[model samples]
Target: MGRQRTVNDHGFWHSPLLQQCTTEDKTALLYLLTSPVSNVIGAYPLVPRIAAAEVGWSKDQWLQVIERLRAEDLVWFDPERMFVWVRIWWFHNLASQTMGPKLRTRTLENIRRLPEPWLAPFLADYKARLNEEQRELLNTLLAGEFSENDASVPHGYRIDASSNFSLYNNNANAKPNSNVTPTLEAQAQVPVDKSGIPPESHAQVEAAIANAQRKGIVKADTQAIIAAVAKQYQAGRPPRDAGAYTYSIAQNLASVATEPSPPAPPSESELTAWADLCFCWPTDNPSSFIRVDKAGFCEQVTIENGNARHGYMPLGPSKLLVALREGRLRKISAADFEDLAKGSRP
Candidate 1:
């Protein structure tokens, strides 16, 4: 009795298509072709460790081979997330050959008749290489098999071959509003603290500003900090309120200071003044006044001429308050102030 062959055995030995490939290429090709059927998605089955083990190579050696494959366009690797996708040229060639000359001819002919101009070049090139019978079959297949009118083509009919053409046009004609306002709830949830500062977000802003200073990219100042925060808000950072901005600045500053080459430090007077402002004035009580000392303590004071009226204001307890004052907390609008005051205890 003749030996009964399993699909895997048949695919491995008797597949005429596999005969053309070298042993290593054949293994790689089989791995790729089976991957989709094996339910692999995104980067696929060739993770770094698995790829190394499968190929019986060191991690570094496997990486180099992967790089070479990528450079040849035979494989794709996304290093950031460590994923891979492979394209098996041999499989594509095998499939094309298996369709036979007659079917190829019919598919070409029908592609030529497609009303779309983009398909024209492909049809013309195909027809030039194929025999008359093959061309006829190719056209018939394209028209009857892959045609939008074909019930088998899923969704029944497709007038356009490329989905992107309409997508581009739709996007071009779309209008985006430039001045959309946030809803009250969204605004309220945006990290506005009682003192009108954001909570728990000082680190980011400080880091950004400090980075700019260290790189000699920009000078650190109230305006510079605000500008940095504004840029972040525009770029979709959350908690788009004053307090978050203040916290971000502080965070950024601390981060930049940690680098090997720290930027020049602020003068003693400047530091003292900043400490005073952040601690003296309460963000929640914008109406309340404060005084600051060089030693970083706050003294209560009355506001006069929009400034502390009493003797040199003592430094405050809250470092955040000082940073806020340095950040130049703007006077809240009358309506905003009224809202804030209503929430305050008398």
Candidate 2:
């Protein structure tokens, strides 16, 4: 289900930032704020093309709004990733008035999917601005898990600016005051602590990761899969099941085979020459496996599991010298040698 977002009628109209933008700019900003695609944690994938289509703006017009908003420090955009983040997204939503971590997790899922550089700004904003209750919600978002005990978990909201900063729901159209007001609850740290972990669990988890490395898994790529599970464990999300839970996470890594590097594409001259020599190549263009026979006929051959059919063997540029050293081709006529060098055997 899409998350229910609320906008305050009084607060938004009162906002100086909203007042300064042009009619077109304000509409674009509103669209971005209320976009279904935006995650509550604020960072969202949005390109000029998407914004233009969604907000009824031309390409040039949408870009101008981006430049203006960015100048005001209201939004940050990554052209390379086509991702944009709203600077104050969390501050406005702290009035969610909902209980438990589930609400926070909805937004955090999007944040978790972000790279550090993208998530850092929002996190920094939260750190500098959130009150005690809001901080726990932030922690829950970062933790990516729930407390089994509702009593120990905090129900969250921020105080108005007089207390710290003005807390308002930054929605675009909705006006209903929620049945609940976001607030703070005081409680003990509830999840079973690290003491519940078995003594040998750390060793087992490390060994699992090391074994994966030996099998050629890129440590960097799998870091997310590893860090998330570990963070949850440390936060007391599942203490007694530490070994089994983490092992299950690593098991996923074990199942995936390392992807091989893609072969370099053949250049235009090489392709033309190969076509002239009547050699077949991969239509998808990943790699060409070519073979030469004793008859001085050159053709591209496909091999599977280190074996070939019809007496053809694996022979590419890499294997050419090896084939010669192995005496696979002991004699070559002058004409055949010339044809081979020219890649045009008659």
Candidate 3:
């Protein structure tokens, strides 16, 4: 089956914008709405010729329609970048004022894939359109400033495209130019006196960040770290120890950016204990089990009739051990073996 995309039939035909469009303009709008190159975010890569040809319109005819649409604030196109931003696409499709973290993550992922030119404009549009509550929700989800007009933008970063940092462009690859500039982490090194923190505790805050950096646990900037700590103080839940609190907050922020490392392989006896606890004993008639192989790795295996059918990457026994200790691993069943064999989550 072909991939399917959602089109708000009611919203599209009923929109006041459609009333302003000519028949040709409506056709062009429909093409943009259902275009194969378009994505859920409505911002996507496309050359002018491809769009023009898709609708069986001459290049000039398509450009004329596009110009009319742009004049009415219906769509935005960047000729040099070959990208289009279909205005109000989100309003028509996503519809909801509030976005959950998963949807927000998906939206940001699509936005980041656009040519760099689209980043500021896309954010600016959202900032202008969303209400205070919606903006705060997005900001919290982004975990950084989104305003292009903000002073922080001049410090030489865009959104963190690669996930090392959030809205303040912590991704090392987000450098907009070849000229050398301070990175987000470097900017954080400069102390933030405006964080509403007591001057006396400032040194402690810096020390905590430094300590975390020394331990290779901190991946965020100093300002972000201070902001996190300051939030706690404002909430009337000040930590008993300033340094420890700062370190913990920094660790939490770093945890969001850092990918977790695999646990070390456990002893053979430990794996067996985990397997027994989880009821994954070697029954040899379609079941999922955990076992320690000769390579000293604990692998999750699916077997049927005394033959191994599927296997997952061997993991350290730590997670299984904890699950076993807490009686959390559910009893294995035929359904689990099917899920394991199909590479589906159980």
- Estimate the Cα RMSD of every predicted model relative to the unseen true structure: 23.5, 20.3, 23.9
lDDT of 2 at 44: 79
In the range 1-346, model 1's lDDT, one tens digit per residue, is 3322112454344433233345654555455545432221112434666666666756665565555444323455555445454432222223234238544454344334433432442333233334566556656666644544331332211111111111111123334322332211222334322222122233223323333332333433434355555556556665433333443463454223333443333446765654533222345655554333456454443444554434333333344344554665543334443333344312
Clashing pairs in 2: 7-171, 161-165, 161-166
- Model 2: weakest 10-residue lDDT segment is 157-166
Residue 260 in candidate 2 has what lDDT?
54
Using all chains and alpha carbons, the TM-scores for the candidates as numbered come to: 0.20, 0.38, 0.38
TM-score of 1: 0.20
Q: Best by lDDT, which number?
A: 3
Tens digit per residue, CA lDDT, model 2, 1-346: 8767655544444443344567776676677778878766667787777778887767767766666565444566666667777653543555233223565556556756665454443444444344567767666555534333321213321111011111222233424322232111111233222233332343333323333333333233334435645677567675343333443464553434576554443444444443323232333431233444433334543334443322343333344434433444333344543443344432
lDDT, model 1:
0.39
User: Over 4 Å off in model 1, which ranges?
Assistant: 1-26, 35-45, 89-346
User: For each candidate, what is the lDDT?
Assistant: 0.39, 0.46, 0.58
Q: Judge candidate 3 at residue 37 and give its lDDT.
A: 83
User: What would the C-alpha RMSD of candidate 3 be, to one decimal place?
Assistant: 23.9
